[model samples]
Target: MNYTLHQLQVFLKISQTLSITRAAEELNLTQPAVSIQLRNLQDQFDIPLTEVIGRRLYLTDFGREIALAAEKVLNEAYAINHRTLAHKGLLYGKLKVSVVSTGKYVMPYFLTEFMRQHEGIELVMDVTNRQKVVDSVANNEVDFALVSILPPHLNVARLDLMPNKLYLVGAGPTGQLREEAEPELLKKLPLIYREAGSGTRQMMESFLAAHQIVVKKRLELTSNEAVKQALLAGLGYSVMPLIGLKSELLNNDLQILPMAGLPLQTVWMLIWPKDKQFSPVAQAYLAYIRDHKDAIVQQHFGWYERFL
Candidate 1:
């Protein structure tokens, strides 16, 4: 294409502000320079981009189409520049990670030291349910994903990060059931379930099935915080990752039911598409996890020993 990125940027700015003077001011260029760039871009396309009418400027149909293309082009160019910097041994890049809801509780601690060390790295973390995390991984939309249970369908490069233990917790009746009859806890208590697509919910289902326990569902919650709050309010008993309940557990606001086959243990993992190569930022973070995961987990979850 004859149109340069500089000219396209100038045109896009003009399209956004609808004023040559304003665009020039925002771009730190003279009005004449902005106009010249816009003119050059329009010339390359052989189309009139903007029209002045009644003291206002508006983009023509062709201009609007080109503006969309310009936006995509600029975004791709920005990504390329960041990639180039990363290849040059500069940590100036963005790292996008999709994490399951419960993983949110642990990922920040893992990221803190890494981020502190790499000042130029921009971290974008997407906290969602397990299914969406998997979708992002499948589509290669994110650099990595943090999840407890990996889906069996997708081929991924997996790294075990730490242990995630699921606890049966509640406020009132649920605890009484644990004390009253250990085996009947699952069958008798009103159970609050994480939504169907969640990894926690999947684990809960598997546990229930393996033990031939059928419980009454009291509620379905979408998030870890929501489930925790519900359990605290005596809404019902729910299975949750222990990492998310540190504060409440420490404060004794919620009780962990000491039932048989309790504290279901699973590994927290970092995964990326098998077909894609890891970026420097992703590689660095993965290496950090490999080197320091045990220390970090021990530091944050030292309280775990008291329960044992």
Candidate 2:
């Protein structure tokens, strides 16, 4: 059976998302276009690769197997192109990284110069919750994963990028509460939170549990931006990363509540599975990050040091 690389590419996206609409959106193709490609790819195989049940798409066992094969094929294809570019003294290929949601703020600063220099590189940065980022690393779906909290079970190598400082913050008009009154204040105030499986949420939970402080959970939001909006609307306070709150903090839109054990700290890390082979683009990224992380942090995040 013969299938074009584009068909395989389209099928791989479909397999990942399990939705024609989502695959189309991600691929920047029309839904009809995606469907046509999928149908064409399906025609090459006699057996069903996908099945629709209860209006939801599910890949057949054969589909899952083929998807894996398709990924290998695509990676090799990318490798071939990258190798040719490398011989011409240029880096080329896809650099896929999955980052925990709040990491979006940090990753871009590190990426800007590298991406600008390597114009031939294709960058795909997936911003999702901690669990998804971890899964991406575990499955080798991405070249690297950026996270604050490392998964204890995964055998991985990491490069520490910078400090991730989390503080309990609320809509501003700074209050003059003493450190001793902080826990009692938390008990009385409604707490906004990131959704479960978020690194921020995990850190917040652990902080509360350790201090034996139980907060009234007012709202749970999915993304950092959502949580920030909830804070701006004076909905509630949350433990938020300082990296994402620079403007808010400076403008007094949010105020960090100084508690006894305030500003819980973790290191932002670029992690990869220990045994995974790095692509040319991935290796170039690692090298660029290593050479420039210090300068990047000082340039982009120097204001952060004051909070520390």
Candidate 3:
């Protein structure tokens, strides 16, 4: 039997609520109509859908199977509705965005501010490592990603929404270490770098490579905080983005070492497909990021002078 969208919807309602009376109330249909729809669907599949157990309705094995399929059909119908709505400039749908863990410190402020301005839009954020963020955007799993930097040819489009300066942090020995802690300072100490494929790590490597400052013996770790802690513990010094430890530097827990030609300044980028640009709401967020990024840093870092 050919199933209609209404029948699929009613069946899903019953499947979710597990009560024919409640499903009818939700669909604004009589109980008899709801029962008839479920029967028609069960008959089409030639299977038993429900059984009476202890005076409560229970799904038979076949009924459970059909309910799952029916839910998928209902979901697809909703997706089609959303796609049409999107085409009409509605911008009122789930926008999945992924970001590297480090960007969690900065990107959210811009995104939250944008959401407050566009109340109709719904946002879903998936925060993970930098590699995962890039992969999600590359495979179309996420519509956009905010990361420190992208690969040389990552098969996507990118926009540097705002400038992001790298900071050399340490609470270790001063003078020899601090004086040589600039972007070109990697050669002076055993540099503790983030794991490979980290947007931050990769950017730092490329910058150092460009300046011909190969680290003497590079040690790799995973998180930004770990690197900072190691530096403060006097394990080794590391280069990190200013966004990650802006507060620590300001609070005197860490010191930003002064170095010559070190920490080649890069920026946080809003990355997406070269083929599929961005939705109108996404464009708006990008604009707001550029306009208000400096203010965001000033608010979070406390002492605005450090950022400059």
Candidates in order, TM-scores: namely 0.71, 0.75, 0.63
Mark the 10 consecutive residues where model 3 has the least summed lDDT: 299-308
Highest-scoring model, TM-score: 2
> What would you estimate as the lDDT of candidate 1?
0.84
Question: Arrange candidates by lDDT, highest first: which order?
Answer: 2, 1, 3
lDDT of 3: 0.75
Residue-level lDDT of model 1, residues 94-114, one tens digit each, is 789999988888789889999
True-structure lDDT of candidate 2: 0.90
Compared with the true structure, what per-residue lDDT tens digits does model 2 show for residues 155-181?
Answer: 999999999999888896445543434
Q: What is the lDDT of residue 149 in candidate 1?
A: 88
Ranking by TM-score: 2, 1, 3
Query: Model 3, 36-124: lDDT tens per residue?
Result: 99888767776678877887888888778878988888778778877876787665666778988788876777677667766557687
Q: Model 2, 111: alpha-carbon shift in Å?
A: 1.4
